[model samples]
Every structure is written in structure tokens, then in C-alpha cells.
Target: MSERPGLDIKLPNGRHIQYRGIRYHGSPQHIFWFEFLPTLLDHTIREELKKTAELAKSTSVSVEQSVAEVVALLNNLVQRAYIRAVDVDRSLMGDGFTKGEARDVAHNVEGYNKYIVEQSNVYVLEYSSNEEKVNYAIVQEDVLDIKPNFCGIGININALWRKIKGKFLP
Candidate 1:
């Protein structure tokens, strides 16, 4: 009689949930955790934008004005990411590029951040699943790294809060 190969599976209870000669519970959830890090960063940016807009509004600023201000703030937040330089078309000229144009470029920051987070979440979910099909250990490690990055983004957002408070208060 031929001997079957041993399987290695991870259970939800922090134990190896094994299946027919393989790990069954080792799904993309492990990988999804790592992918969650960037999504969290994007979420922090969104929260900062919203908070800044709220502060602007409370100070008697119009919604449009607040949006513009938030956009500028967001530009600073992700300066390292070079998001604005990459996505914004500085070459475009005309009414759209005017200083007081209704469609201010800064106002698009929130939308851009939202789109990035949504797309990243979708991709992470799919990628995690694929990783599970291959190897769960890799995905788990990736998620562990993301946790620290997410925390860093949160700290950045906190600093943004302080700046907004200082700017609008008194």
C-alpha cells in the first residue's frame, strides 16, 4: 500500500487545521491582514481630510473652500508617496487650471484617496486568496509587516489633527 503525504493546516484556534494531506484553514485571511496595512494608511489620510474639512467649516469656511484646504493638507500628508505629482497634470492649462476654478485640483484629493483604498482592499482580498492557494506562511508574514506601517500612518494622522486644531483654534 502507498503512504499518503502529510498535510499542514492552520486552524482558527491557533492550531494546525489539517486536511487531506494539506493545510485547509490556511486561507488568504493571513495575507489579507498584511494588505490591510496600506488600506489603513489610506483610511487615515481620508480621516485627516475629513477632520480638516470639518475644522474649516466650523471656522465659517464654505464646503468648497474646506475641500480645497483639505486637499492641500492631504498633498502634504502623502508627499513622500508623490501622489499629487504623479496623478495631477500640471501641464493642463485653461479654466480647469485657474486659481479660482470651481473644480479645484486640491478638492480631488479625498476622491483619489478613496479610490486608492477601495482598489487596494479589493486587490488584497484577491491576493490573499491566491497566496493561500500557494502558501499561507508568506501571507501571514506580509500582514505582520503591514501592522507597523498602519500604526505609523495613524501617528501621521494624529499629527495632522494637532495642526488643524492649532490653525483654527484661537
Candidate 2:
């Protein structure tokens, strides 16, 4: 058997597709700008960078080294958050989907995303299936409005409490 698990596709719009393996769903830069940046802003990330710069100035550590460290940290955080978003997208779609099935879902999601962005700056709502309209998506400026399915598919929530409750609650 080949080491490759499934097919890889790079779309014209810069989105990537991996059938069974890992594929980043949306634009990571968008997630960084729309989701991560706002949370990181005026937070420990800034304070840590300032502290590192000051420490580099007083000590023998070069400014370049400090900058590189900060960059690496931010990159790690961004990647993890992006992956989490992709997982949520997958869960919303359904379970035990093949590579081809995932590709179809991704393609549909991308189409809706492009269509919505072209029309306006607000969020785009999408149904998972054309027939039943059971599952849906709500995306704005590329950031998905993820929440518990109990809220009804495609509906937006002010806070993703249940969606993210596991991360905080013991």
C-alpha cells in the first residue's frame, strides 16, 4: 500500500483539499485576522513580546532571537485554532465520511463562501444538504459562527459557550 492516504487538491482560490488526510478548511490568515487577532490583541501575547524585547535589550539575547521566538509562538497558536475550526466543520457535516464525500462538502462550503463574500461583508448561511436543510453553516468574513447544534443549524450565537465549554470547564 502507498503511504499516501488520499488525494490532495489545491483549488484556484488558494483553498486546499485532502480526501482522508489533513486539510486546512478555510484561510488561516482570515482566521488569524478575524478571530485570533482580536483575542490576542491587548493580551498576554503583546505583553510577552514587549517583555522579550526589553529582556533582549538588557541582556545579550539578540532582538532577532526574541522576535523569532514570538513569531513561532504566535504561529503555533494560530495553527491550533485553525485546526480546531476545521474539526468543528467536519463534525457539523456528519461522521465517517469518505475522502470523496469530504471533498464534496468542502467544495460546496467553498462555493457558498465565495458567493456570500461577493455579495456583502456580513455572514453567509448555508444548508448542509439541499433536500432536508437539516445541517447548515453561518460564516462571516471567513470566520465560521460555530455553536451547539441544539441552537438549530446555521443560526448565530453571541457566545459559543457550549461549543467551547469543554476547553475551560473541569
Best of the candidates, lDDT: 1
TM-score, one value per model: 0.28, 0.30
Cα lDDT of model 1 by residue, 71-150, tens digit: 55554565433343333223222235542212233434555566544543333333333433246344334332322246
**Whole-model lDDT, candidate 1?**
0.44
Q: Which one is best on TM-score? A: 2
RMSD of each: 24.6, 22.0
lDDT of 2 by residue, 32-124 (tens): 334443344324345555566566556755544454566556545545544565555455445446321222234433443343233221111
lDDT of each: 0.44, 0.44
Clashing pairs in 2: none
